[model samples]
Target: MATTAVINGERLWSALMAMAEIGRTPAGGVRRLALSDEDRRARDLLVEWLREAGCAVRVDDLGNIYGRRDGDDAGATAVVCGSHLDTVPTGGRFDGVLGVLAALEAVRAMRDADLRTRRPVEVVCWTNEEGVRFAPAMLASGVVCGRFTVDEAHAARDQDGRTFGEELRR
Candidate 1:
């Protein structure tokens, strides 16, 4: 017989609502462009939530955020999952938020159930997935996967002439 564990939909919905408030627009949408102050606030909120869920959180050199839940075996490779949190100038509330929040919910569910696996679970919040603020989308992942050099990705500038690297440092 197989047992099924139900996801806490209420919790997930509440989280989504809270995140939506970070970069909310008058039209009830999101305006969290890549590396914007709104995006940073959203990232900070996610980091706080990740910490509350007992995840070990860290931000990469390119400003991609990661939350990790350790497993039984320390030497085992991690099982990574996640999506971007950045959005377009006028994106919907759930665009990339769903994936990242879903990953957080999974970790929270596992913690609630006292479930431990052999491999660590990592949730990532990728930076600059939407090219609205910074050209060439998926900049962080591109650097991570060797598709683009860190220098090259960092050099990318927004319409206002602010470099991605500069915004990341702020």
Candidate 2:
């Protein structure tokens, strides 16, 4: 899709609403816990939209998703922008969701306008950001940024004894 036809406020709002619809609580909060079906669905939906906008998408072992726009130089670091898709058990609508969708919307707008930067742009979605399921927050980013080891993240368990590695598989 072209950048001009990409980022529409209506569409963005609709997408946000759609994500909110998953695991919606009576009080207008979302309960899509990390690695749950709802979380996976939301992640998949975002990746689908990213692909539609000509982004090359990849997910790290810990489920840190990256949607990249190809750049002239393959070696350039991406101008990445995004937050997390995972939400708390009683999470508000905006929170980190807006940050993730906004980055995607920006990419769509850029594509529609045929805009290009010296470095490629990436729309990212980090996993388990809220830590509602895994205890500590930013587990994925911690691993990705070298703040923590993959083994350490894998050892993380929820209140129910489920490990982060097992959750990522689901």
Candidate 3:
């Protein structure tokens, strides 16, 4: 016999719809540039939802958000999941957000099922993935993995002459 983990499709759809409304474009797409006010709201909502699902949340220096859910072992390598939350200036509803929301839904489903795995699980929301607003896409994840330096990323500027670090600090 195989056990199945059930997830609420309606809940996931609602969450996606809610996120889409934050930076909705005139053409029915999203325009959530990284470090923008709309992006901040979406980030806050993700943190709130993660908290409601009982995850320990933290935001890194480069603005990557991590939500960890503990499993049987206390000191184990986590099974990481998730993707960037930021989208291009006029991106579709599911562009990068679906991966983030799917990870959240997985955590929610695990919580609902009371399932326990051997290793911990963590969901990460990477920052500044779309280069439309900030130069050099995948900045946060690259900085973490040593592919790019923090100083390099911080110095990156937008079309409006605002630095990545400046927007991050705002």
Candidate 4:
């Protein structure tokens, strides 16, 4: 059977615009610092979208979001794609947001195309990737890949002297 997979650019653009509004700055940049209220809202919106697209969403202690579309073999490893949602104080709308939205669009396209694969597909959102509020970028991803420890990531402090773990729990 012939199948088609087409990305809805308009839908992707709409999603981007919607997210860009979350932490909108006066200078047209986003200030969605990690674990902040803006970050939480963005996470909630993304999770809602993922579930709407038929994915099972999970968030870790470090606040990494994974939206999974199961495959025929539930035990198989997943093919994942995504980027962080949190941004620096002056982060552009397209920097990390585009990759995330594109991945979301891919999942949506797959659903539209009725595509199937042996391995599950997932969209991931890494936490504190910019390190604006926390030190050392790629914090959550580094921990998952062993570059950093959970304690180290949690110990990171912001300008107000609040620990990363403290804000995450807030």
lDDT of each: 0.90, 0.87, 0.91, 0.92
- Count clashing residue pairs per candidate: 0, 7, 0, 0
For residues 45-141, write the lDDT of model 2, one tens digit per residue: 9999999989999998899899999877778988889998788778998778899999999888888788766688999999999988996899889
Give one digit per residue, the lDDT tens place, for model 4 in 119-162. 99999999999988899999999999999999999999999999
Per-residue lDDT tens digits for candidate 1, residues 1-170, read 11333579999999999989988999999999988889999999999999998999999899999999998898999999889888988899999999999999998888887777779999999999887788798888989999998999889999899999999998
- The count of backbone overlaps in candidate 3 is 0
Tell me the lDDT of model 1 at 74. Answer: 87
Minimum summed lDDT over a 10-residue window in model 1 is located at 1-10
Best of the two (1, 2) by lDDT: 1
TM-score of 4: 0.96
Instruction: Note the residue pairs that clash in candidate 4.
Output: none
lDDT of 1 at 83: 93
lDDT of 3 by residue, 14-106 (tens): 999999999999999998999999999999999999999999999988999999999899888999999977888779999889999999999
As for candidate 1, its clashing pairs are none
Stretches > 4 Å off in candidate 2: 1-7
> What's the lDDT for residue 146 in model 1?
95
